[model samples]
Target chain A: MKLDSAGLEILSGGECLNLLASAPIGRIVFTDRALPAVQPVNFCLLDGNIVIRTAPGSKLAAAARNAVVAFEADDFDATFRTGWSVTAVGHARAVSEPEEIARLSALPLTPWVPGTHDHFIVMAPEQISGRRLSR
Target chain B: MKLDSAGLEILSGGECLNLLASAPIGRIVFTDRALPAVQPVNFCLLDGNIVIRTAPGSKLAAAARNAVVAFEADDFDATFRTGWSVTAVGHARAVSEPEEIARLSALPLTPWVPGTHDHFIVMAPEQISGRRLSR
Candidate 1:
């Protein structure tokens, strides 16, 4: 909970989750061909896990299955030079159960990509950390 | 370039670099402690490479030196359910020479965090790809 020299406030775990819940778009980071790859995706918070819908055979769906990943979201005002960023580190698991997938699809977690989003990847936040830069 | 089912247009390499130059913020994904980690950073494009300033002892600075990383930036309209995302994948190198660092510091690549950002990391975009979702 220490503030950095630039007045960056380290947010608690609860605050980190709250900030994450406030954003709908985030970047999911995973290993691709032994190198890091990232892409922006629309997601929702379901039962403390970040849920994202992807199409089968997609790079994200392929790389994220049962893999350690990171999700990051933030809102920064370039003019004001202030913003808060929250990052969630966890392991992503594909939702294979039909009943659970159906239940999750009923939520507001709609994919921005136009197509069948039959695959669901859920990342349970194992480590949540956030920092807010302010005056 | 191929279009997805939902009208997602695959952008060319030149176009991806153009989109990247239009933004000032992006997420840097790197491996930390043998796991993937992501953090939002302020950067600029210089001579076809992504340049960022970081504190000397920051985790990003430590992990990014001579490491393969991914930098992603995007702009999406939730209301319209459309937007474009561009990602740059390359190896990051620390700018150790004082002359280059001084010259780069004169650019608009100011560090958002409050502190001495003497360490400069530059990533030459080896693989650039972008997708634009539109009707």
Candidate 2:
């Protein structure tokens, strides 16, 4: 196991992607009012890309258009102090073309809330990294 | 039950703080290489301020110094599709003074990993908000 400077195990690119795919929920980081902001969303991994559905006019949609963003997902056992976190940095593009929107709509992605989630944001990660902390 | 435009219930400020205090882990969003980055950390709520400990030379410690960042914590039940999320945005200042650091050392805050977490970052949120999704 490769360990980082802090002694936590460093995850390979494949392991990072696999861990990201295994989780249904993740946090998206974007700039809001020129400062960093985070929002939790249900996401899916498609062809090594991250996809999230949101309202077209939602705050995230506004900030994520062609924007550099970070997506993170993890699971931990607080009692055992063990967990792994995966972070993917990429450019978020809003799907506006009818054909692309139709394609994404066919995916299993669904919003966690009850409302219209017609917009699709697809991110192809330029950097994927993860770390695992063991008890 | 106040609902936002997206149909998610908007939680009150007090409720947001309460929920934040209940969570042991949260994702902290900060700028890195001129892009957004997120990492999950175990944190504590003290006097309505968010405090997290990290390595003195860690990436998080460097990026969080006097910078505007966001902290988010949430809990969800995928089976029932019920969840709540709280987001706090403010300036993150690294605590360096000896007396202050000495006082913080007495807190219950502890690092999730097995390493030295001597640097402290505290954020007294200027803006706090939260939302809930019901099944």
Best by lDDT: 2
The complex in candidate 2 yields a DockQ of: 0.83
Give each candidate's fraction of reference contacts reproduced.
Answer: 0.79, 0.84
Query: Which residue pairs collide in model 2, if any?
Result: none
Chain B TM-scores per candidate, in order, are 0.94, 0.98
lDDT of 2 by residue, B1-135 (tens): 999998989999999999999998998999988988898999989999999999999999999999998999999888888999999999999998999999899999988777799999999999999999986
Candidate 1, after superposition: displacement of residue A68 in Å? 0.5
Instruction: Give one digit per residue, the lDDT tens place, for model 1 in A22-68.
Output: 88798899998898999888899988899999998898999999999
**B114, model 2: CA deviation in Å?**
1.7
C-alpha TM-score for every candidate = 0.95, 0.97
Give stretches of model 2 more than 4 Å off. Answer: none
